[model samples]
Target: MTIYEPTQEALRGELLQRLAKLSAPSSAKGSVPHGVDSGVNVFGYCVNARERFARSRLPHPAVVVVLSGTKEVWRGDVAQRFPRGVPFAIPAGLEIDLVNIPDPQSGRYESICITVDAPLRQSLRASLNGLPDGPSIPGSFGIALSADLVEAYGHAASALAAPEAATAEAVARHRIVEILLLLSGTHVGRMFVAVDRAEQLEAIVYADPSYAWRVEEVAGMLGMGASTLRRHLKQAGTSFRQVCLSARMATAGSLLSAPGYSVTQAAQAAGYASRSHFARQVRAAHGVAPGRLRSVA
Candidate 1:
């Protein structure tokens, strides 16, 4: 099917209808179940009702397209709102709070988020290897939707709907690459071309938080000198110790929220030998005890 650029109102109406059709019926109030899985690590999101989830950290960089209603993303002390027809790019390895507010009239919020993985980044870098660099944009940007972007998203939705088709994956991959290329023209896109070494190190540590990670050991694993790794991390605005702590805390929070995991298990999974220390850290970072997370989860 051909993707057409519709008027903003028409686009919103169509996206909302798609969301309503995809949403599952459940008794749980304001719960966000999984939406579309594009089979290439990219997923789509649809919300039927307004839901306010607490602060959480996103481990990967994502492009969030707000189709209908609005969303509030809080990072540190700053809060930004993304309304319909806008796309927001979230940086990797940042702690954030998200609030998904549906349209008051329709009582629904619809959006799509495509996660950028290492393979996609490599693909993007290879594609832009010899291109003349454009004017450098900032590492961060505001959310705004354009006519081309809306049409691109509409096409993506269609491709996702029929994953069994031989061309579905190609279409999805192409669209993802297209989006990244458009982003690469901006300053923020430059950041995605090369994966941040510090973020890579953080992911390594996060995957196995129970392992005792040392800076020199991690540097060795990265095939770099300790001092060089430290320098690179400093440039990334963090240190080895900080990354370890952040990863552990984030893992602990996730574990606590999962069923069949006790506070002790969460603490252990986070590499905290001392339960009391784990509790203190969790309370400090999340403003609640580890036990509280289990109840909410």
Candidate 2:
């Protein structure tokens, strides 16, 4: 089927209109995040002003379609810039530094996030032929947002937005499946594979970054001995301390992203007692001072 590809600006305008209709009105400075509770399989997140965050961990394997402005993601030494109308796939438990730059005219940064959770991933594996069982290529990467995929995303959004609760779930699932089926053919499909040991540990720490976590305690939670956990981490080329610090910093970044969250509050949430210490740590890790993390001007 031939799908008409609209101009990127037109596509963004259409998506923004649909999103505004679906989402509640927001304050002047913050973000509006719509999810399953809003009866949609597709979620929309918009930031009114430019925002920068360090070590934001993605909890699930997902694809983010940038509808407007730009999203800059930093994963280790590699930096990827996703402009409007592009789709990028992210693996579960991956930590990334992000800069959300709003459009100069519209002054908003918006994107759609579709999570391919465990059940959906497994379902895709079972339904597809010749699915690989090996480990995924590390990190997130952008993929071509084909015209057909864009049309499929529209269908998925419509299905989830339908009024009939009974049929909405089934229809939404079907639409999502169609989108994923198309996505599976792309190079980014490799990211759909199993999560690694380091990812598992990172997720646990992210769940409660404020906790006083010890190697033995976390290892026990993962049902492995401390030594075994250390050995696995060694193979993964990371240590428990590194993972914990990363997760904590990610948690802090998330806290800092939202409006009305002071640096002190973010520090406390990330398990840091002193705000100065937290600021220093953030600068050391991300090279952006806490005070300069979110620059409105």
Predictions in order: lDDT: 0.64, 0.66
lDDT of 1 at 107: 73
Q: Write the per-residue lDDT of candidate 2 for residues 1-297, one digit (tens) a residue.
A: 997767766655554454344443444334344435222245667787888888776656678877668999875455889887667776655566888998888777777777766656666666665453221211236665556776777777776666467776677777777888887776456445335566567655654566677888766655679999899999999999998888777656655655677788778778899888899998887678776774421
Q: Please, what's the RMSD in Å of model 1?
A: 16.0
As for candidate 1, its clashing pairs are: none
Q: Encode model 1's per-residue lDDT on 1-297: one tens digit a residue.
A: 999766666665554454333243433234233322332355545576777666565555677766557988875466778887556676654446788887888776766677777666766777888322321211133433445555565566656666679887678667656666776665345335546677567645643576677888767656678999999999989999988887777778767776888899888878889989999999987889998977999
List the candidates' TM-scores in order: 0.54, 0.56
**Ten contiguous residues with the weakest lDDT in model 1:** 131-140
Off by over 4 Å in 2: 1-41, 130-140, 164-166, 195-297
Model 2 Cα shift for residue 81 (angstroms): 0.7
Instruction: Give candidate 1 regions above 4 Å deviation.
Output: 1-39, 130-140, 143-147, 198-297
